[model samples]
Target: MAKAQDKEAKAAAKKARKQASKERRQQLWQAFQMQRKEDKRLIPYMVGLFVLIVAIFVGLGLLFGSVWLLLPLGIVLGLLAAFILFGRRVQRTVYTRAEGQPGAAGWALGNMRGQWRVKQAVSGNAHLDAVHRVIGKPGVILVGEGSATRVKPLLAQEKKKAARVVGDTPIYEIVVGNDDGQIPLNKLERHINKLPKNIDGKRMETLEGRLSALGGRNPQGPGMPKGPMPGNAKVRGMQRTARRKG
Candidate 1:
């Protein structure tokens, strides 16, 4: 009797998960449809990508005389190509919408791959000038976004504060924008990734604990929300799908 009950519970759980997944996909599709209305090039781009992928695969299959074996493979590869193109388009859309918005830097930092602790809006002013802090194996990175003149001072001040806590550890400063000395928004992740890894995992943990003592304090106001920007549900869905595929 207990074994039968367990089986029933497992079946019910599976059904619930399936329903949830179906609902999520529906939401993602609806969101994608709405975005498509504004992004006229999206469909054409995906179609082109699919055709290119299929052509390459089919050509290779014919050359190898494995048309039967590779036909299905071609279809699968084409679908994946389209899906990846969709994700890239969604990412570009999200970034375009986020550009010049307050807390945009924080949003970019949140999307960064790897285990970095991000503290947003650690300091800011009425003009939306803000400083965000990140701690990782690279040590401390202070990112300032807003007017360069105003943010320069903010970054300097934040650096001093962080240095006090992280004595001898590297503290890098970056300004996100398209100015002469600033890194572009799209390249922000790559820039962070390229930073020298000065500390190891154990040092990272110690640094995190030390910084945690600083606690949360928003001088201007609360930082940007921790995850994807509001109204970016479709982008979030695409990100999940891409991650799963990866």
Candidate 2:
């Protein structure tokens, strides 16, 4: 009986969270629609697509005479798949709008959906070239977007800085653009979030605590220009590359 009650409670909480997320997505879509006059038609199509996918999955399970459990399972899986496509379309639209604009990365990140904890303009240039670090169990992800040459230096410097406070934590870096090595903007967040978590929740909290003393703002340049270069921020990558070429 207790187990049953616990299951019931869990189900209720999950439903509540889903409803809240839907409401938030609706509000966000509505706001996006206002500013994006062209996307107004997409709202209904997006909904209809999801509904159609769900109906098909349900019909398939019934027609195939699958196990009773497959009905709900298929419906859920189908909806997830449809929404994922829906989400990608939304991202592509945003990426299109933000293309080549100053601070485009900042805006793309700022408007990211769901509960991603992102710090904006973390460390960036006036031209909107920037590096954003997101810390979680997936370890330290250093995302750099700008000139490949410039961003590499920034990535190395910040990695060093993060290491001082992060100890032996895992660090990953990627440049965002259409370069030979860059990850496309459409799939950036999914790629980051799907990485294996290296640090546990507690360690992340500790690392964040240590990182707070570094700089309130990640600064556009090496030292934030406004604060002391924490024990970790180093700019050696650029220097070494220069020497190698020279």
Give the least accurate 10-residue stretch of model 2, judged by summed lDDT. 226-235
Which runs in model 2 stand beyond 4 Å of their true positions?
1-88, 110-117, 217-246
Q: What clash count goes with each model? A: 0, 2
Model 2 residue 41 CA deviation in Å: 9.0
Regions more than 4 Å wrong, model 1: 1-5, 218-246
- The TM-scores, one per candidate, come to 0.86, 0.58
The per-residue C-alpha lDDT of model 1 at residue 210 equals 84
True-vs-predicted CA distance for residue 182, candidate 2, Å: 0.8
User: What are the per-residue Cα lDDT tens digits for candidate 1 across 81-102?
Assistant: 8877776766677777777777
lDDT of 2 at 210: 76
For candidate 2, the per-residue lDDT at 93 reads 55
Query: Which residue pairs show backbone clashes in model 2?
Result: 137-197, 161-232
Global lDDT scores for all candidate models: 0.79, 0.61
Q: How far is candidate 2 from the true structure (C-alpha RMSD, Å)?
A: 12.8
